[model samples]
Target: MTDAAARGLWITLEGGDGAGKTTQAGLLESWLRERGREVVRTREPGGTEVGTLIRDIVLHHRGDVAPRAEALLYAADRAHHVATLVRPALARGQVVVQDRYLDSSVAYQGAGRVLDAAEVRELSLWATEGALPDLTVLLDLDPAAARARLDAADKPFDRLEAEREEFHVRVREAFRALADAEPQRFLVLDASRPAADLAAAVRERVTALL
Candidate 1:
């Protein structure tokens, strides 16, 4: 492995909207910090200034954005995010705990938006120059349950969040397919479980990596 690849532990949490990824990322960050680990907690589509602007365009634009354009926007954010924030933090030997990553693009744009998954993934690989997480914790949840959680939150849905249930179902399936394809790199967890329990499971898996 290259020195860049060996720099630090890159961990990402992925799931459909309202799947508890943000909550778990917080817990993991706190847990790691308690153990004296220098942890960088961040998220996709808004990890940097450039990405934050791209995020609003992609998720909160008033009108329609062509599917391909949307995908490319996400790719652009990923490129900047990895180079400016993620890779540098990792190179400093910090545990980078992120709320979302490239897999989200594959699931949301590729599967949910009905684009070519392989092509979308290839675009991201080219964008980030193939930077990948050491581990990706996938919070698996049923689309209906996920929707219910979102509804309970009572917040206006973003563009992707407002997508139909069918879109979210496709996204869920895509996430599972990704986990199955690379079992060693992914830790799939049921999102319906209590948050504490899920955090414990994550802590266990992450401990092994440390």
Candidate 2:
């Protein structure tokens, strides 16, 4: 295939805050590198230097950010990140394993914040020029269990994570709905599974793509 036709694969990890996305991302990156593939590991809202500033305001600000404003901030970060970092790396045929994507916005802002999911997704699509991942691995977990994991980590909660259990429940349901609506694009897995097993499943699907 021509370079344009064989553009680099994009993989995104989606789940609640304590669903082990970071661990899986690290394992996936290591596995891809071991196979001699150039991998670009990144996360939304902080993937670019500009995005870092946005991330701070969105996640760390001690003020109430309107739902629409929060969504716009995330979109702005996405636009810059895709334009400057993600697109260039993909053009060089590098595998991008990202921590989150538009899906997170839909789940967090749309469902968690009680905004319109479709409108949120459309805004993101417009911002990123309709960019979508080749694969989206959804780590399904109970919000309570996820909260327990977060507690065990002993880290302060971010804006989204600091929300109520009901909000997290809504976010989880939104993620499941999105995955259901696009079975071909999503691989839904129980996050309670062993890390090795989860990694293996991810590798299996990625192997097929490679």
Q: What is candidate 2's lDDT per residue for 1-210, written digit by digit as tens?
A: 123237888899999999999999999999999999999999998999999999999999999999999999999999999989888888888999999999999999999999999999999999999988889999999999999999999989998899999999999999999999999899999999999999999999999888
TM-score of each prediction: 0.97, 0.97
Candidate 1 lDDT score relative to the true structure: 0.93
- Overall local distance difference test of candidate 2: 0.94
The window of 10 residues in a row where model 2 has the poorest summed lDDT is 1-10
Writing each residue's lDDT as its tens digit, candidate 1 over 1-210 gives: 134336878899999999999999999999999999899999999989998999999999999999999999999999999999988888898889998998999999999999999999999999999888989999999999999999999999999999999999999999999999999889999999999999999999999888
- Which residue pairs in candidate 1 collide? none
Model 1 lowest lDDT segment of ten: 1-10
Task: Give the residue spans of candidate 1 off by over 4 A.
Answer: 1-6
Q: lDDT of each model, Cα atoms only?
A: 0.93, 0.94
Clashes per candidate (backbone, < 3 Å): 0, 0
What RMSD does each model have against the real structure? 1.4, 1.7
